[model samples]
Target: MPIHEKSLIRKENLVENESLVIDGVDVSGHWSTFITGRSLTDYNDDMQDEIAALPGGENIHRCWQCGSCTNACTVNAVNPEFNPRYWIYLIRLGMEEELLRDKDIIWQCVSCNKCTYACPRDVVPEGVMKATAHWLELKGHTPKSPSTEFDEEFSGQVIKTGKIEESRVIMNFFRRTEQPLAQPWLVALIKGLAFRFPVFYLMRMGMAVVRRPRTRNWAKSRRAINEYVQEVEAANRAAVGAKGGH
Candidate 1:
């Protein structure tokens, strides 16, 4: 469906004449308002396909502009500009330029899944939002979000050793994100754990940290998982025509 919502129209695109006369009839103020015509020349025909290639974006083709997703979106409730339905409409039409207008806020999805539940076509609107955010990052339109950074750290730990060290993951994430390790909450939590845990348990935790233990016989599984991850990364880059690493 074509976008007819006045709120969706960009402010610059809406023209208003305080004093105007058309065909010998005075049409002033809001009566003289007109929306500027838009002509798109930089459409990326492969946008929808590229998004579909990513995880959680496979069902984008099922969207029918039902508007249910936006209605149920948690972020949209607070910020109307965060409209999933409109973004999906732009994506389906390959309106890359239009989609980029909201690049900054697209990653604000809270992943509440309300949109997914409200979508009648099983479009999984929440997933589409995530995929769109990923696309923006991959396309160099936006920086990596904090959540993405944390996900990388967490996933890297699991993939490397087939197990994760919570303290290591948090520290690495904070380091990568340039966050200081001495936050008040973190210090308090560490102190609480140190005092509450038994002496032997604390010692064991310290030993695990120093040793960086891995799952038994995890080398072979690590290799297989690494190969699969590489393959998927290659596919994702090929799909979006992204060059170099994010």
Candidate 2:
């Protein structure tokens, strides 16, 4: 327990520098050299601004990737590579090509909002995920999402009709699927069991979106939204630059 004895013990454990020893493994006198290269540090400025422009993406600056978001996600338990913490880090770093290639996973996120609930900074990882999906589509990555298909079909219906027709959207959506007839049979089963419901399902959960119809001053709202998006993007670029420099 004396100082010199402890020093002797430490010396006994020490290996020649870079001798490939870890945890008592004697990898010394190795014939080969293994080069484990680190990733090149990058500055991904574009993603910050673009993501901040999304519905809940404005708060991305607050994130400090504690891995809590990924831990809180049910999907992460199923998809090992789908780490929410790493995804945000990638966006903040401006790894555009990687993100585009990763669009499939990004698009597949169920938007369960579990990550948002766990985020200490209120970074809203769920919204950032959606923002990433949109960003992927903007980069010319074709979206392979049922949600994307639903959006396209629903929009077509809305523009064609003044109101959203639930039956029509459901029918059109399933018709576009591989087994078009499966839905009608499923609907019949649901109705037979009295389980079929409408948009009011969300309303019962207190979500205002499904409960009420929205109206907008399109001309004014459009201009205002565009300006806000521009400002957030500028701020995000500045933040990313500052962080990268540090």
- Tell me the alpha-carbon RMSD of every candidate: 3.8, 11.3
Cα misplacement distance, residue 190 of candidate 2 (Å): 6.2
Q: Candidate 2: minimum summed lDDT over ten consecutive residues — where?
A: 237-246
Estimate every model's Cα lDDT from 0 to 1.
0.89, 0.66
Question: All candidates' TM-scores?
Answer: 0.83, 0.58
What is candidate 2's lDDT per residue for 1-246, written digit by digit as tens?
A: 013333433343433434556566655543223333347556556677877776567787788979889999978899876887888887787776566646788776788899988889999898888766765555446644777778778865544433466656777787775446556878687566555554555445345334433344455655665577567555544544422210
Cα lDDT for residue 217, model 2? 43
For residue 66, what is the lDDT in candidate 2?
92
TM-score of 2: 0.58
Task: Write candidate 1's Cα lDDT for 1-246 as tens digits.
Answer: 123576877789988888888898888877777888878888889999999989889999999998999998899989989999999999999999889989999989999999989999999988999999999999898999988898899999888898898878988999999999999997898788778876976898789789996898888998999999898888888889999776
Residue 175 miss distance in model 2 (angstroms): 3.3
C-alpha lDDT of candidate 1 relative to the true structure: 0.89
